[model samples]
Target: MQILITGGTGLIGKQLCKALLAEGHELTVFSRNPASVPAKCGAGVHAIGALGEWHPGKTFDAVINLAGEPIVDARWTARRKQVLWDSRVTLTKELVRHIATAGRKPAVLISGSAVGYYGNRGDTAMYEAADAGEDFAAQLCKAWEDAAHAAEQVGVRVCLLRTGLILSNKGGLLGRMLPAFKLGLGARLGNGKQWMSWVHIDDYVAMVLKLLHDSFASGDQASLALASGPYNMTAPQPATNAEFTAALAKALHRPALFAAPAPLLRLAMGERAGLILEGQKVLPGKMTAAGYRFQYPNLDDALGNLFGR
Candidate 1:
């Protein structure tokens, strides 16, 4: 398969590209800095500065839309929010537009969404069937998914991967937390009762492969209908914030002796703190029902695999 990926330099995109390349798939990393793909994704893969840079005759078997600004990197100021919105909502629209005009459309468009679509549900468990909330994150995901679904009108199969917290040693949430945990400064956020739905990066990448392969088999309406739309790319088992903190502390042989109060977090991070203090217990109902098996179903195994504990 020849796959075109946006945000190929991101944590998940980098690993996904490496894995797909190893599987004998041809790749093209679409980026603002095409030259950086060689340093980030290594050789053999093609890189184009923009979709416009591609020759009119060039096409792809699949287009994975993963380009988006990091939501949690900064406090949710008006400017920051616009950047986040434009990166995802705007960029995805452009990708879909290109697909609409392409001489040869891709078989499937695997667009990125997030578990944040459900909003801060406290301890409530969320599935693909759940109605989305009205928060900024949820609204953002809805718009993002809407843009990707436009390809379906052109006969391209669409998969909206509502991914959870990706746990990997290479980078992402776990990488950012490791130094503090290793230094014994790790602490629970708020009361630590909020549910955190997560997946091992390896399993997350595998889910994409599963969906990509399944698209080929989704010839008739029945098979195609069963596989498309919002798939919660999360583990079967969801953990509370307290359980996750304890497990990380135990894995690192460090003491989780402090608790960061919710009020302080809100004060420090403003609205962005809601992402840390409030979470949904998302379940991969559709993905699992479709026969995708998880490599690390439990938090312990996932942490162990990443930290070598």
Candidate 2:
């Protein structure tokens, strides 16, 4: 299969590309830095600096949309919020436009979203059928998903990935926290009761592969029929912030005796602090129901694997 992927230079995109390549699929990455994509994603990946390059003459069997600015990297000032919105919602809208004009529509669009769509729901378990949240992050995800859904009108199957905190040694949430935990300065945030819905990087890639290959044949009783809808790309079991902290500390043979108060986080991060201080207990309801098995279902096992314990 021929696949066109946006944000192919990102952490998840890079890993997904490697998996797709290993499966003998041809990949073309749409990147802002096309030259860097081959080096970052892998060799043999065709890189395009502009979306315009995907004209009507060009065709792709599938399109993967994962382009987005790092949401929690900086304070959510008015300008920063727009940057986030443009990177995700606006960019997706444009991608859909391209798909609409394509001479041959792709079979499916595996677009990126986030569990943040559920807002800061304390302990309420979120599924694909749950109502969307009204916070900034939630609204952002909602709009992003909505944009991708437009592809349905053009007869393209759309899969919305409501991704969680992806744990990998390369670079992600774990990469940022490893230094602190290794020095034995690991700390829980706020009261540490907020849920942390997460998935191992390997499991995430496998899930994507399943979605890409699963039969989408309509009215075929034998097919998995994973045609279209939102998928919570999280592990079956979720852990509280405190549990995750302890697990990380234990994995690194460190002590977690400190707490970053909510007030301090808010002061330092402003609105962006909500991303850290609040969370949803998102379960991979759709993925598991579709018979997808997780490589790292438990927090301890995932951390231990990453830390080589």
Candidate 3:
């Protein structure tokens, strides 16, 4: 399958490209700059100058949309919020418009969404069929998924990935926390009790490929079923913030941290401090029910794989 990925340079995108290449699948990237394609993505992986240039005449088996701004790095000011929103929702709108205009529709459009769609669901389980929450991130994810779904109106099968925190040593939350923990300065955030849904990079890449190959490549009859809706690419087990901290510290052979006062996080991250202090206990209910298997189903196993515990 010739897959065209929008954010072929991001952490998840890079890993996904490599996995596809290893599986002997063709890859074409829709990026602003062809040269920006990572070295691992290689010569066979040709790239287009922009998503706007996509035409149905050049249809591919699948189009994975992972383009978005980094959510946790910056303060959530009004302007920053707009940037975050535009990167996800606005760009998604543009991508859908391009697909609609293209004469040939890609078999499947696997669009990026997030677990934040459930927004701070303290105790309730979140399913892919569930309604989106009512917060900034929630609203942003809702709008983003809506645009992706518009492709359905144009007769395209679309899949929205309400992904969880991707745990990788290369980047994401685990990367940022590893150094601190290794230096023995690791500590819990707030009460360290917020539920965090996570997926190993291996499982994440596999799920995306499976979704692409199953419904899109076979030219199977499309329905309004989940074949075109949303799915959670998360692990079956979700650990609390404290559990993650302890597992990570153990992986690094360091002492686990004591409790971190919740106020400190709010002071450090401002309104966005909740990004760390609060999170959804998203169960991979949909992924498992869909028959996906996880290489690392537990938090301790995932951490051990990363740090050699």
Q: lDDT winner among the candidates?
A: 2
Candidate 2 per-residue lDDT, tens place, 154-249, comes to 988899999999999999899899899889999999999999999999999999888888734556644445546899999999999999999999
Q: How high is each candidate's TM-score?
A: 0.97, 0.98, 0.94
Ranking by lDDT: 2, 1, 3
- lDDT tens digits, residue span 1-309, model 3: 778888887889998998889989888887767877747466678888777567658767678899898998999999999999888888888888877777667778999999998888886778877788888888888898998889888888888888999998888888888777878888988888888888988888988877777664343454234355788888988888888888788888899656778887788888788778888888777667667788999888987887766
Error of 3 at 211 (Å): 0.7
lDDT of 3 at 309: 67
* Cα RMSD, each candidate: 1.2, 1.2, 1.9
What local distance difference test score does each model get?
0.90, 0.92, 0.82
**Model 3 residue-pair collision total:** 1
**Regions of candidate 2 where Cα sits further than 4 Å from its true position:** 215-224
- Number of backbone collisions per candidate, in order? 0, 0, 1
lDDT of 1: 0.90
